[model samples]
Target chain A: MSTGNWLDARAGGARLSRRGVLVGGGLLVGGGLLLAGCGGRERPSIESRDVGSDRDRNKRRLREILDRQTEAVKNKDEKAYLADLDSSNSDLVEHERMVFANLRQFEFAEFGYNTRRVAAHGDYTFGPVFRITQLTADESPVGAAPAETFRYRLAPKDGRLVIAEITPASPGDQKDALLSGPPADEAWNMTPLRVVQAADNVWLVGDDSVPDLEKFAAAAAAEAAIVRRLWEGRARFPGDVMYLTRDDDNYRRWFSLGKSSNFLPEISGFQTSRTGVRQNGQVYSDQRAGAAILINLKNIRDYYSGEDPRVTMHHELAHSVTAQLRATPSIISDLGSPTWAVEGFATWATGVRWPSEASRYRSQLRNGLGSFKGLPSSKDFYGAKRSLNYLLGWSVFAYIAQIKGREAAVEFYAQVIPLNDTLEPFVELPIFDGICERTLGTSAGAFLEGWQRFVRRGAGA
Target chain B: MLMVAAIVGLLGALVAGVGAYLPTNRYQATATTVPCRRVVCIPVLKASAVIDALKAKGHPCEQERDHHWKCELMVGTLTFETTIEEVEGLISDVSVLVVRPPDEEPTEAVMDYLLWLAALPYTADEALTEEINDWVVDRIEADEDAEAEIGGYNYYVVTSNPGSIRLRVIGALR
Candidate 1:
């Protein structure tokens, strides 16, 4: 592998505008939930009794892991709760710390993980996913912010059953073993959060250095000001902007990524919320959602200079501020807007002054002259197709801000977000043209022409 | 004596020609580059562009789910496979592999031909792609050969300038 400079990964170190896909699994019994890929060594010859005994022992260990976690929450013992986790992965260890701290703030009459089905894969075992749950104060009922269905992969480490990986559950992953509640339950589990008040509306986590955090908070404030100023009436759910430091050991555990470069390494920053509905097994929804933004300090330093984490914060928080603007189930906001608009608006919010993004776009355009067939899809948002989609998307909204005042663009954005582009008979232009005419009262053709021209000149298209 | 010298020269040329043709019967290589160390920075992005150039050169590229991209290019017996890492919107680094089916140590003639394979990036043209398909045939029909000698050992070098991406390809026969 080529030893790229540190900056290579820093700029691309975060999630772009993407759909949330969680990976998790259920509790693993000592026996086998499903045996796979054993290469003839895996035999079904073992008697059911021995397998049952092994399964029982593993269940006991799993129960202890979860019970200890519950007791820790009850006693407010953050360290003890984290102690149940497999600390083999340092980042996960740190991430669990933040998760534990976050959940600690909430009142938990009951806190626990319930496993469903656990598979045995040779040395490792995982299947389905266990859920983390908590009760509201007074133990009335679990209402919202249920923890995302996190799967537990267990392996014996240091003489105890330990969690090897905690991934968000995907489709076809629902299994039956030790389920205790609906998979769609909402109860976000937060680890310990290092809190610092960056502003009245913003809080910085895990860092004592206030100057940079303050700058990021101030920048977020600026972006917030724009969001409020532009769409005060429509823009809802604002306050308590939690800025998670990128390199934070506890904070990094929030995301489970595969492969360092192709996808896992792209984590720059992200906006996750305790708000949003768990509709369709989705973790976060736009409706009635409040958010927390994780900021990669390195990404901020590389892209926006070390002076402010707000560089990426502005872009990420832009999503947070309007995160639930188009909650699911709404006729217009159901499908969500195109990646161009979703990310473009965020980029535009950052003031579109940075030359790096556009500069890279230009070179990208030079490499693939006719690559831009039309608007960027969500696939383009994350993939080897690279940042062309981001650049083109930004350019689109930048064009919008140029042609339609930024305020008008914001208004149009809020209005059209509910439009679905993924549905059948999807037509990018007619839909956009109609929306432009209705919301912004501009012709889409002229606007597209202008955007194309802008891309040509600026991106060397 | 004159007849013997002439025959010796002809035989030497035939042997070198055959040597170049033999290894390429099944040689292969793979190259991949990582673009990022943490996130996608300019350096990483730039390195991705180099991968982009490779893709642009018409090699088939495949992104493994959400990991790196693996691209394959086969030119005669020399097959080069390149892999590149991309994260979210970031590109990491590049790694390449050169492979061949069951082979002994590379002879000078074979290495000499491999230099052409290495110089494909420098050629900045698809002409080399076609050349790779018929390397042995071309080697046998060739009228020109490496003549540079340093420290009594002959070596072949191709200064490849691949679309403003500079890399050096050097080869020697033992």
Candidate 2:
């Protein structure tokens, strides 16, 4: 439902905070001693010892590298962070640097790695591989991505362990790219785009023939300004947008987060992670940072002319700004937020506002009013006609913003969208009634009736 | 130019003829079922059957007293619950609501079992037929009683086992 950073290019990092060092790094501190005793090289001990001890020594060496990252993040030192990474991978360094910058803005109170399991891919093309099934965590508003399992592939660089690759991992990525997986650089986009300045707030990444990239950037900058205007001195949204062209395979490899089918033109462009600007938490922390705007060039080129990347840019950026609220640390249970509210808020913020030009929702609401009930269940979000929920949701939120006031509506949303621990096959009627009563100071029926009246008026207008 | 055009036409015809005959549809599992005339029978995954699924192997399952089953399943951190719904002591429908994890593409056995559970009391309605296709990897069976196709996956397929008695089955994938 949100932007997926498949084979994400975002550069973000996380580590235990100063306090976390005393706790998480306590064991790692011992490993650090082992690492120092070995003098930055794991090979000598492996070669000198038996196979079992060699494996143990190798794992300890890998843990030392992770501990260094934890220490660096804890100390807020960019150099120490990069020291654990393969400096030979300049792009990776740059990416991690971007991640550090983004996370520093949040000033996390604490961070540490959790649930680490390592695998030895004895010999791979990138180098000897050691994969760790670990995730990063932090105590902050911007959170980390731990939705899926991730393995950090550590290959030998200068006789020491250095992170080789992580994102866009799949069964095929392992077989095809071996140790390096997908390039840490811009290998997915293949085309080297010249970054051209557009807006004071935007940078256009494109080459000739794709003049639309700048047009897309212009639209994004415009949307960002509109959001800033609506936000009106609320929390600032800082992450900028980046666009690139590539084949559909890369799109599938980079962004399809399971729920969606790639190569579908419906996805105009995507903003990776809920917050693409800050990296927090332990697992898949890098994915949440440096939230970049990636447009599916092939989808545009094939059809759609990339004319209005605005629709998608606005929708996704809407996510990037609100990403903080979706985190576990935040009060809102983002995963539990009704699809209508989660998506509709963005839709109304952009397309559904002001005069409602050629409103598909007007027609949909005309019919939906007949069967309008309570809030949409989780089933409605993933169901076949999910677009309907978006339209209906936009109408509902638009109605609320108009009646209840925009700022209050946004605030109310953050308040109402709390966690629902119930398992699947969900029905939102009871949940909707409770949320409406607490947030809107009315019952679900009253809320529906108010929305219906707005729909009718909007349809007439 | 005339000769070239003729050759192209001939090749196109040959390709089309081969395409028409070849079984383009590969159904990993299928079944034939007879419609229930009176008491509608439903089939839910026997907890044992769920464990049999290769990817779903080792996932712990608990069938509640109310006759609902839940599983905290995983294929590399892509965790989700596969819930089964029962009607009248028989498992009527099995649905995974939020969404299925992408990597763990539920096997044919799983889909077939789910479809069979859903297609019970086949009222010969189009809605049920559509539901079967939506969940069964986009495969559908319109026929009612006969051994229509080998890939009649996720249907109350009429098998070699006697009478108008319909049994749920997962067909072989070839």
True contacts kept of 2: 0.00
TM-score of 2: 0.45
User: What TM-score would each prediction reach against the true structure?
Assistant: 0.44, 0.45
Over A1-461, each residue of candidate 2 has an lDDT whose tens digit, in order, gives 00111001000101112343234334434543443353332211101112233433444555566567767777878888778777788887777776554433332333433222223455321221222211121123333322222345566788876777645344344444232221222322233345545565455455444655555656667776676566555443354545555545444444443224323444656655422211211233223333445666655544445444656666666655554444232222224545566677777776544344326556775665555554465534646656666777677666776677777677655654444323342233587577678767888778878877766665333
Q: Looking at model 2 chain A, which ten-residue stretch has the lowest summed lDDT?
A: A5-14
Docking class of 2: incorrect
lDDT of 2 at A306: 40
**Which digits, one per residue and each the tens of the lDDT, describe model 2 over residues B1-174?**
432233223223322332233221111121122122332222222333332331234446666547566654433323334455444544334444212222334333233333433333221222322223332322212112222221222333321111111223222122
- Residue-level lDDT of model 1, residues B79-137, one tens digit each, is 34555555544433334443332133322323333333332221211122222212222
Q: What's the distance in Å from true for residue A173, model 1? A: 4.9
The local lDDT score (0 to 100) that residue B1 gets in candidate 1 is: 47
